[model samples]
Target chain A: MTDPPDRRPGGRTARVRAQVLDAVRAELAEGGHEGLTVEGVATRAGVHRTTVYRRWRDVGGLLADLISAAGEIDWQPPDTGSLRGDLTALNEEILESLTVRPSFAVALMAASFHSEQAARAQTRLWEDRYAQCEVVVARAAGRGELPPGDTDARGLLIAATAPLYHASVLMRADPDPRLPARAAAAAVLAAAAGAFSAGGGTA
Target chain B: MTDPPDRRPGGRTARVRAQVLDAVRAELAEGGHEGLTVEGVATRAGVHRTTVYRRWRDVGGLLADLISAAGEIDWQPPDTGSLRGDLTALNEEILESLTVRPSFAVALMAASFHSEQAARAQTRLWEDRYAQCEVVVARAAGRGELPPGDTDARGLLIAATAPLYHASVLMRADPDPRLPARAAAAAVLAAAAGAFSAGGGTA
Candidate 1:
């Protein structure tokens, strides 16, 4: 089947999608999920309501598309020659993203809680983000810095992020400047002790 | 000022408070935060709206009281003599609570995201829960199961719960049957290595 020109990468269709998604973010920031509307996003994005409805159908659909689009962004894992450095850098990046737009982060999480589709999107988002960490672990193993066997990268990554999320999201505590380093240190310490390896404690 | 008989613990006032809070949970489970109504809750509790309003004032007020009431319930730490056993018991408790009423858990979390009052309540809830874990750590340290001197009970408790929360809450993944054991093992392994002591990696 021949591809439509507007549907190609970086085409008009893609631009419209990006514009609409950006508008959705703005709406969420201004009024939260409850106040967001298809009409509002359409107007903010300078797109027709019909188009928004045709593409997204509703707020849940828009959220799913927004999450998927966010996952599509290019993300590269840090390679600082050591497992500790790379993990620290990764955590710092997460800390920055979360702290930079905490309300947005909270809104996204809140949306995921109420809607099944949004929850699925969040799962996909986490899976994709975890893939980046896997690469970092793979590189560390290649450099002989990590154990040369099957490793549970998921446990290490979750351990690194969970404390930060607990403090930031659940507790609503002010961001601790040392949290990134502490998280990375803990994860590295645990991983070094084989806690995150296959059949290990964290496994 | 002396306390009135009705205002004392296990009295009529306390009974009313418990009834109202229980109704609130039922409302949240059935309709979520958006659909929860003060009138509905009052009716469900077989109390007048005036009584609910006099006590709670509004839904936010009800949520705050509900969260506090939940915290006030007797929650003793499992004194299993071993840090590993205690942590496993704690995680098991969390697993049972979350799994038994998944919708209620999600509703509570979602409410915290939108309302500052709810967020504060959630923070208080965590603080209260962590206190129970702190006692477990203190007892373990006394028994020489954990390191001497000051320990970071918060880190160990958070580490034990974070992965489970990440999987069950954020990713909406089904609760892993082995998660309680794995979480305890990881925390115990790390804590044994001083990762949860003063000046440890997680500190």
Candidate 2:
């Protein structure tokens, strides 16, 4: 088959980009945003300082690029047979990413708070992730798992996932082994009660 | 009536502490964590730099003390006669704090990510806030609004409030006017269905 025009070539440029990004993650994990220097990344990546300066310009640029790189990954929402199972799997993935020692995910989130470019990039990545995950809701609706009428898929999805972020990232709470499934089950029950229906009210 | 022994005196120390913390909030709102400094805060508070240095010692100290000061505020959760109404009021308060121009709440959260002292102080403040809000659940249970068994009040509260933070702080989504009430309604429904009951499962 002919090579796809949009496919990235496995060339030296790709290799350098991968190396530099890896170095960025390592430096961020070790020293956080305050200590992430372009020079440090260059030294770690074995690239010339001038090359790093010319390509990435500053720490903000490197951070923005790192987030953009994350969006290129071929990630998919879980395909568990039930809505609750799917949500549980999704939450498990989120928990694992947040709980890993010196987590690149947590470091990147902290770095975003310190950099405007990174914040904007992080927002884009979040929107993209939400959009991707909306498929889970759509599948549930098709399977007759959701309540009647138009469900606010985005609202349901956010409700399902936000607790994990709130607990792990904001509160720095010790992980409760049962929390992922418990939160998912709560969201599923709420959704099934038409709580997430468009134009739904507290009445 | 006599003054309580534990009550803080309205003395020079109290006045200075208030002014310095006010300056810290203003500085954080204007310039974020990167620009907050002891000298700048002292200048703004009209206090000597040495005094600030002696008291706070560093930016981390300033951040931690600022958070501690927040805990001293005489704030109370809303008692709106129903779980959904109370939760809606709580969410509105949170939304206002997160969305105000040059939001001090957002700035403090960002600063917490950058400083270990701030992070610990923030965690304490969060735990305190959650503990204070538990009364909302207790009131709901007393009114026969909750299910028949023990409820996981923390889980329920987190579900009700996490969507706002996930939206405004994490994804930077534009404020949805109805979200506060809607999220509360969803959480209330889940709680009524025993989704937040102790030892609950997806089954």
TM-score of chain B of each: 0.87, 0.93
Question: B110, model 1: CA deviation in Å?
Answer: 1.6
Q: How does each model score on TM-score?
A: 0.91, 0.94
Which lDDT tens digits does candidate 1 get at residues A120-143? 888898888887679888887788
- Model 1 TM-score is 0.91
Relative to the unseen true structure, what is the C-alpha lDDT of residue A151 in candidate 1, on a scale of 0 to 100? 80
Clashing pairs in 2: none
Q: Give the clash count for model 1.
A: 0
**Model 1 chain B weakest 10-residue run by lDDT:** B1-10
Clashes (candidate 2): 0
Query: For each predicted model, how many residue pairs clash, with residues at least 3 apart or on different chains?
Result: 0, 0
For A1-203, candidate 2 gives per-residue lDDT tens digits of: 33234455776668778989999988988887779999999999998888889998999989999999999999999999889999999999999999988887887888888788999999999989989999999999999998768989889999999999999999999987788898899999999888987666466
Q: Which 10 successive residues of model 2 chain B have the least lDDT summed?
A: B1-10
Docking class of 1: medium
